[model samples]
Target: MALSIRQKRVRRISGDPVDGVVVQGPVDGLATGTPLYSVAVQGTIDGRTTCRPRGWRFGTWNVGTLTGRSLEVVEELQRRMVDVAALQEVRWKGEGTRFVGAKGGRYKLWWKGDDGTGGVGVMVREELLEQ
Candidate 1:
């Protein structure tokens, strides 16, 4: 979605003593209390403002069982450039975080299950962990 705000309004809302702009307000078509921020760009045209495109790629899949194909899942997600993924029927016991895949394609898998029958999991790219 695109949001149009005046330069003066941007300055007023971003009252932080820091350098970047802190955009906090009701975004149209978005849920209430959604967080937003703005980063200063290096270059811009005389009469036009530049907007950097930023978004997350999410996906969902029913893997039946994650018993021994966790690495394969991670590799596939990486190949597709998926930032986050939700998995069903993980068939794993307990709940914890596991790091899978090799360097440059690493991912963190978080799973929760009562027995070894049905479970759910979420995998996130390792780089996104710091953010």
Candidate 2:
């Protein structure tokens, strides 16, 4: 299934309709380097909105050997509210299957490794796909 996000513009105080301008774009970061397009629609200045110190967190970590720590690592990810993660030196040989987490969470794991030494993969929270 393919999912996308489209936002609608808010109304002005004077009850006037604002002009909406949409910008589309794509980014390539996969091993195949396939492009994924996204659209952003321009809207009125929602002056009422404000910024907060809290924000989304994403990063990469070296799991060393994720053999017996799959659940542990995933649970830690939940604790940190990690939206995206890139794993390195997983120490797992061969390409592993999708990572399943609590509450029906999931991830895709790909590795080109040698003898459980060095492996790399990007772990995307399944919810990220909805965006």
Candidate 3:
């Protein structure tokens, strides 16, 4: 089936600092790969109106359980000028250097959860972050 185009506008009512909500619609006419969604969130945390810009790009993968490799995926992810990465289904032994090495040591990671059960991981680029 062909993908559909969707556009949605969301207005914030309350002052919530943390949120994980998806914007209503797709920005471009295509929705098959990397549907780009832009978000502009403005609110007052402490009587100060702050505007935060965020972009969420969505991709679909059919990697089966215990199939496909994390290293290869990381390589592909590196191609993008991504400031940060949220990785999942990653497994590494010993120090995380091995994985960092896989990313060409271009990133420093903070492993929030290391249960070895494929959870969320954050990778940040030093150069982009310093800017």
Candidate 4:
């Protein structure tokens, strides 16, 4: 699936004031309190396919489970400008940096689950990979 990202001006945002990473702007296509990768993934706000501005978004969430659908989550990552996302209960097997999504770019998932029950992982953005 191709990510519908409108590459506009880079909206730099810092995950937090203390972290000092530049992050700005909100996801245009997403609604308030909606699961980013839910059945409703796209919509027009004003006759334009909403796009993500460049920035660093950071957060943590309990995914409950993770698999192929993780690709959908990757879109959410870019859509939200999340530079790093710490996910719990991923329910994945083993551990490694598994590349995902259409960008051909990738995210690193270091996971450990007990028979697909409980797992943890952190996804880092491509631009900020070296760190």
Q: What is the TM-score of each candidate against the true structure?
A: 0.61, 0.52, 0.43, 0.54
Give the 10-residue window scoring lowest on summed lDDT in candidate 3: 58-67
Decide which is better by lDDT, 2 or 4: 4
Better of 3 and 4 by TM-score: 4
Task: Indicate which candidate wins on lDDT.
Answer: 1
Residue lDDT tens for model 2, 25-116? 23222222223333343344464333232233455677777777777767766665665667777787777557557656665455557788
Candidate 3 lDDT, 1-131, residue by residue in tens: 44444745554555476323336444432212444355556556566666666543333222222125544544544554344555545443223422343434465554433455554455565455466
Give per-residue lDDT, candidate 4, residue 10: 30
Q: Which order, best to worst by lDDT?
A: 1, 4, 2, 3
- Higher-lDDT candidate among 3 and 4? 4
lDDT for residue 28 in candidate 1, whole number 0-100: 22
Each model's lDDT comes to 0.67, 0.56, 0.46, 0.58
- Best-to-worst order by TM-score is 1, 4, 2, 3
Q: Which runs in model 2 stand beyond 4 Å of their true positions?
A: 1-56
lDDT of 1: 0.67
* Candidate 2 local distance difference test against the native: 0.56
Per-residue lDDT of candidate 4, residues 1-131 (tens digit): 45343322233334422222222222333222322221122223455554433345565667767776688778777777566777888888777666666664566656676777798888887667775
